[model samples]
Target: MQEWFVDVAEHIADGDPIYLACEECGQVALPPRTVCPDCAGRSLEQRPLSETATVTAETTIFSSTPRYAEETPYTIVIATFEEGVRLTGQLRGAETVERGEEVRLGVESDGDHWLITFTPSD
Candidate 1:
């Protein structure tokens, strides 16, 4: 699982974030996985994901894990893309995000790794 996430970060750093979709069931998995969670399909293929998504849910984090403890009071959001896939990323470039707000996906280097981020759009 950690390697899967690392691949996602690397892809984002390359400016081409991608997700894995099960060839048999069409279930998309962010961070790419060998098996589809929805159907247990083994043949997964890389799929292009949109750079824009809509905020579907959000919350202010007053506390966070050790990795993000220094960035408390930050916002995390669940954004849904055109691929019908939803991903969770830290919200940026806005103090507040409302449900259904449009957001553009982005990546940021966090020392040794990259982070998934989203900024308000229009």
Candidate 2:
């Protein structure tokens, strides 16, 4: 899991689009993948992910999860990129966001490490 996080961090730093490549099936998947769901492959290649995406759905979480204690009652969105991959991340720059909103991906440093986030477009 740490290795995965490191890979994501490096990809964000390079400003390159992220993707996952399946070793067994040789399929390139965006948003990264632990395994090839199609072929049940265990080996995966992590690469940078795209920054542009559209909000497919969103909701505000009033209760905090164990990992996101500081982010209670925060808005989270499921964004679908042009590559047809979906990802969930923290939503920023707004008190309220809606479905179909165009957003861009960004990396946020949480003092120790970086995490993905969604920023609303102007």
lDDT of each: 0.85, 0.76
Expressed as tens digits, the lDDT of each residue in 29-85 for candidate 2 is 654667787897989866446687899999899988687877687898899887667
lDDT of candidate 2 at residue 92, scale 0 to 100:
91
lDDT of 1 by residue, 21-67 (tens): 89998888875777899999899999777888999999999988897
- Per-residue lDDT for 35 in model 2? 73
How many pairs collide in each candidate, listed in order? 0, 6
Candidate 2 residue-wise lDDT at 63 = 85
Q: Model 1 scores what on Cα lDDT?
A: 0.85
RMSD for each of the candidates: 1.9, 3.3
lDDT of the structure predicted as candidate 2: 0.76
lDDT at 102 for candidate 1? 95
* Model 1 clash tally, residue pairs: 0
- What would the TM-scores of all predictions be? 0.87, 0.73
